[model samples]
Structures are given as structure tokens and as C-alpha cells.
Target: MDLHKLYHVHDFHSRNFLDTYFSSKPDTPFSHETLMYPMEKFHNAFSTGDIKGEVLIDISLGPIIHHLYSAQEYFRDIILLKPTDHCIIEVKKWINSRTGAFDWSHASTFVTEMAGKSDQCEEKEIGLRSAITHVVKYDPNQENVTAPIELPQADCLVLWGVLDVISKDLDDFVGNFRRFSKLLKPGRCLMYYGALNGSFFVVGGERFHIVKYNESNLRSILSDEGYVIRHLEVSQRIIESDLIDFDSVLFCTAYKEQKI
Candidate 1:
């Protein structure tokens, strides 16, 4: 990974994602209708009791604010686990409402609309801010990813957009899944989201690696590890030269009977 081209999630959002894939205008001006589909599915899952959880632990989240609108309402405490110092600092700055935090007002508004609310965008932000109870450093390389902090197993483990960038191969994916599984109590929920068929993405004019995989690989690995997929949703991105390099997005809700 070229250090210069690589950046945190917030940086990626500001640089390439915001206008190219998730533009404010999803109609005649631009098309981001595909990106919004997963958020809506997640929103509906949280709203309709499709995903049940008390404590939700987010693994390797690098300052992502796009999908938490409904998750904040569902989980009492959203613990964001950072795998690096830079990501940790960046996340805290936004969580603490420090200066120049990345703007997520548009995302908040979109989520609010998905939840059938016509207003109260500020309240939604406040609600999310309040729900974020802890920010802890996690080491993805370790067998126990969230080491040094002996936390009780969480009700749910959420892995989103991290596996592709972090995992080098199929084995790495399985290893990380096991590490995350250790954080979830037996029979607990697992919510996963990821970009499909993505090999690399540019951030701030720098390119970073993404381990491309198809639906078969994802479902096979998850099933092998004992997760029962209850709900699954996939969105195919419309191919465009200016748009981000991802073929599709996968969102799923599953539960583990026993960890492998």
C-alpha cells in the first residue's frame, strides 16, 4: 500500500465517495441510488426488529459515519474499535465534536428519511453522539482483536468495509472472522456489509488495496463459521468511469449457533 495514496475512511469519503458514489443529488445530476439501498435495508432491519442486539461492537471502523443513523437508535452503546493510532485519533475528533469534523449531515438526513422522519436532523446527530459510549484501540493482527480491554462478549458484531481492505487473502478473511466471532456471544447477531469485487480504491490521489471477492466466497466462509444468514441484500452499482471501483454492495444479518 502506498502510504501517500492510502487514507482513513473519513478521508476516502471526502475525497472520492461523497461526490462520485454518494452525491447529494441522486437524480438527474448523478446516480447514487445504489448506495442508498443498503442504508435503507439496514434502517428497515433496525426499525422492524429484524436485527436484535443490546451491545453492538464495530470492528475496525475507520471514522465511517454513513451507516450509523439507525444503528444508533437500536444499540444503547456503539463501541467503535480502531486498529491504528491515526484512525483512533480521527474517530475521537469527530466523536468529540472537535473542530472540522467530517460532515455527516447529509447521511443523517437520509437515514432519518428512511426511518420515516421528515425532520430533526440535528437531533439525529445528537442521538448518535450520545449513543457512542466508548472508543477503544483494537489490533486486527492479534488473535484477540480487541485485546488489552477484557470486555464481555457483545450482543452483535458489525464488520463493514474493513475485510476487503485489511485481509490479504481468503485465510486472512477467515482469521479475522474468527477474531471478530470471539467478541460475539454464542447465538448473537452478526451484521456485515462490504463492497464487492473491489480490488483497489484511490483516496486523495493515492491507491489502496482491496481483496476482491464474490458473494459465493462470502456466504461460504460465513456459513462455514456457523452463521445463519437470515436476511441478505445486494446492490449492483452502475458502472461508470467517474464512479468508485466497486461492482456491488452486500448487506446481511446473521446469527451464530456456535463458533468454529
Candidate 2:
């Protein structure tokens, strides 16, 4: 068992620690290669060709273009649906707080640097044409948005960080998906991440909780809502997680059932 596979879902403490652990455990599932396994799956999914006219939706777009481009390159077209620009502001503040310079930024700067690029990409290119589309407002309460914005009929959608906000109340949240599925074409796919266990703590006045649910339960809920499980990845946090807090995480993908 390789630890890389585990990292695909749960992150580890540190690269050095991971290297040492793997060096010692020739046969341990927690090997270094096993730790980074999830990334490979992610990369593979983004690298492999999928059907044409399929769209890829990424929920949180902070300035990570490499991964976005990878997905776009793999899927042909990609759209980023950000719940709020507040996330970008918060990210800016976080960077300023650590770096002591409001003059520098992350994703915003990346966007500026990559200005005028198209949002579409080709297989030979490993980058997004325009890279990201900011969803200024997200009405999780509704299936489609109230604003005059449109998303392509995504064959695949990446539900990255929105699960915590959307899954707050399972019944309502899942119901929202029921209505929202109409916005997508038949057989659209969604990829997402969630915590299997944990508590939501107050961070910057936003209500959040670590989503802890087993695959069986998650599948049951989504299945009842006309969704089917494609893949389930369980992961833990590495020592230096980008997340301010939390030690572990899990991710999964589900596809909307094609209409009868």
C-alpha cells in the first residue's frame, strides 16, 4: 500500500517526514509515493481526454492556474464558479498579513498577469485560455443563479470548497442540487471534497463545519437526488496545509444520472 494514494485524500505532515517515512517503510502503505498519489489521479483526470462540448466547473478559483489549466486542457472548456469575491479579498488579507506587503498578491496578481487570455484551451496547451471566471454571487439556496450569468453545460463540474456551505443542512442542501441539476445537461459530472469528521469553527465570521460523512451515507443522499457516485477519495492533511486549520480531508466525484 502506497501512502501517496492516501495523500490523494488525506495530506501528511511534511515532505521530509514523508520522505523519511517512505525510505524506512519499503512496504508501508504510508510511503512517500503513496502520499502524493491523489495528485496523480487528479492530474490524470485532467490530462486524459473527455467528450467534446463537455464543460468543467471549478467552485473556488483563487489564483491556482496550473491545476485549472490542467483541467481545461483535459476537459476542453472550464469555468470557475466562486461563491464570493470575499474569498479573494480574504486571500489577499491572508497574504498581506504574512508577507507584510499589500503591494503583493497571489491569485489576483496571477489574473492580472494572465490578462486577455481566452478561457478555452487546446490539448497541447497546459493552461486555460482565460483561466478563471469569477462567480461574484452564489445563491446556494437556489439551483441556478439569479444574476445574468450563464455556465456551459458542463460534462464535469469540480465542487471544490462549496460542499461545506452547501451541505450545511443535508435535506435543503441536497434538495437544492435536485433543482440545480436542471441547469446542467444530462450526464454532467461533479467533483468535490469534504471532511469525513470534524467541527466547524468561526473563521472571519463565516459559518463552516467540517463535513464528516461516510461514502455510503453520501452516496445514499446524492443517489436519492438523482446523482451517482463516480469516485470517492479519502485524504488527510499534510503538516503544512493551505487550510488555516484542520488536519485531514476527503474528496469525491459524482455524476448526474442521464435522463430517462
Highest TM-score among the candidates is held by which one? Answer: 1
For residues 21-133, what per-residue lDDT tens digits would candidate 1 score against the true structure? 45465352223433466667767777876565678888743566567678886788788886666666666776788896666777788888776784888888888888888
Q: Rate the local accuracy (lDDT) of all candidates.
A: 0.71, 0.46
lDDT of 2 at 82: 40
Task: Candidate 2: list runs displaced more than 4 Å.
Answer: 1-38, 51-54, 61-66, 88-126, 133-136, 201-207, 237-248
Clashes of each: 1, 25
Model 2: per-residue lDDT, tens digit, 1-260? 11111111222222232233222344533322222333344554554454234566655322222334345445555655544454444333422344532221222223323433333223213244443333334555554753466665666666544454445455654664564565566776666655444444222333234444555666787788778777776766544422234445556667788879
The superposed Cα distance between candidate 1 and the true structure at residue 238, in angstroms, equals: 1.7
User: How high is each candidate's TM-score?
Assistant: 0.85, 0.59
* Highest lDDT against the true fold, candidate: 1
Q: Give the least accurate 10-residue stretch of model 1, judged by summed lDDT.
A: 2-11
* Model 1 TM-score, all chains together: 0.85
State the displacement of the C-alpha of residue 211, model 1, in Å, after optimal TM-score superposition: 0.6
